[model samples]
Target: MSEQAGSPLEDLTAGGPAIDAFELLANETRLAILVTLWESYRPFAEDTTLQFSELRERVGTADSGQFNYHLDRLTDHFVDATDDGYRLSDAGLTVVRSVIAGTGIEERTLEPTTVDMDCKLCGSPAEIAYEDGWVYVFCTECDGLWTDRSDDERGQLARFSLHPAALADRTPEEIYAAAWLTTYQKLHSMIEGVCPTCSGPIERSVVVCEDHEDDGICGNCGRNGRGAARLSCAVCKEWVQSTLGSIAKYHPAVVGFCYRHGLELQYGVESLAQIERRLDEATSKVDLVSETPPRVDVTTEMDGDEIRVRLAEDLTVLEVSERTA
Candidate 1:
């Protein structure tokens, strides 16, 4: 095991040469060696490189053989040797970046808290969890033995590497994105098709409005505004109550029975089923819901010069005719 420095010296620690950009940080001397190298390459602060003996003095360690061992470990992390002396490898540079991001971890590296966990997937114990020793802590069933990402992360885009789907390798970011998208879809479904006006679910009701009979109306809104006719949108396939404005802009398809009709396409009616978008997808597309306001036709007699109109629901203006008598 490597030694670790408590403060700024952690940058020197590294896992295996392959696992982390820096994991061999546990040793004070080793950390010093890396820090010395860091100072040598610094933009300010004396930009000076020193030999092993000079490093020896700077690190002030008694054991020569031990110091050499630490230097060798640091050397292993980098393949590039600068014109003056040892430098970092490109892969080593990547380590420095990981260190900055605090993403680098060693294989089977003990954290401050040692938690013995059961193999979530195969019900294996911690021994097997670390048997192969991975940078990522995943169980095959509970989590795959991944490097940094969890199993669920890889599941979305054919990158999930299960024991069977080892071919499905994915990046931690990809996995995380998939997990988030799935959660978002679920959340959207929960809220979709819900009546914004009444806080009622969207799909279950079927009452129509007379005003915008073309777009389907919300049951709560429709029943409240019972005189209005209602139907579904021809273009977007959403249910909306008929409104004077929506009626002017709406396009309606012959409501096909048994998932029979849809937008005009190659197979027209046959293709409509595919276009019907399963209930899940339809709901998923629902936007942020706010209750649809009941259309109120406020009629105040205008003195032929101006009519007082009530506006609600954002940028909407409706004009009611003044009594002509």
Candidate 2:
């Protein structure tokens, strides 16, 4: 195949040499400058940029030559220098915001506390906890959603990524709500063929456990269900895996079915509990109709009417059957 004229490939070749951006950020001064610019920027203000001397003072660097040397290293890539002053470039803001989001900054943990919702696997009240930038849920009674195959004693119903900033001045219930909302938004984006990390295109596929056994967590496959959808970003290589039934809630057929039953598929701190129960109630059945070609049916019910979403081996919608009871 020949390269198309004026392709994005041209832009990559235009740059003289491949530059390692991380190499320029090795010095503490450059990171401080980025953090300072991020702090000083105000969208509405006329002068969001900070003058060289003022920025140096804010960063507490006494030597002007040393500071300027570091600033010059980051100028074109991370910092934008205008006639008036300097401000963070798009890349600069990304670095600072990632730090603010608790990425690789520190490790924090929250002790287990009973949440308002009951476990979907077992009817026991679910307990929520936070550890290393993730919110985890576990059932007090059953094997939860998945148990570590190596250690049968420990298990978690679900775990979602959440930043440490969300933990401040919030109750355990509030934290769980934030995690749930974040997970829903990210998963929805991924399902629509978008990568949550880099905004790049995502590739999705379905995988079925051939030798599956479900006695709560499925000792053979280590999956609560037989089939799961796996998504990978073509650009960033970020991977996300979830049971096919969980992603079915985003289907228009399921949403419409739940709305007809007086349940809205939505989420907020106040509505998180309601949405959890409503989704669980509507999607009460998941059956693996075939294992050879890897087909699964995620069924949602309302007022005795059932909508079965049949997914193919790659998780594409093969058929949607509505059965009236």
TM-scores of the models, in the given order? 0.25, 0.87
User: What's the lDDT for all of these models?
Assistant: 0.36, 0.79
1-325 per-residue lDDT for model 2 (tens digits):
5667897566545644233475677688988999899999887788899999999999999999999999999899989999999999887887788788885445567898897888776578888888878788878887776654353354688888888887877799888888877877778889888898789998888887788786667777777877788888999787777878767777888778777777777544246677577647776577888887877889888788988898887667888878888
TM-score top scorer: 2
Writing each residue's lDDT as its tens digit, candidate 1 over 135-204 gives 2233333223222333333211112111211113433333323332333233233224433223444432
Model 2 bad stretches (over 4 Å): 1-19, 43-46, 103-107, 149-154, 267-270
Highest lDDT scorer? 2
- Regions more than 4 Å wrong, model 1: 1-23, 43-48, 100-325
lDDT of 2 at 150: 56
lDDT of candidate 1 at residue 204, scale 0 to 100: 23
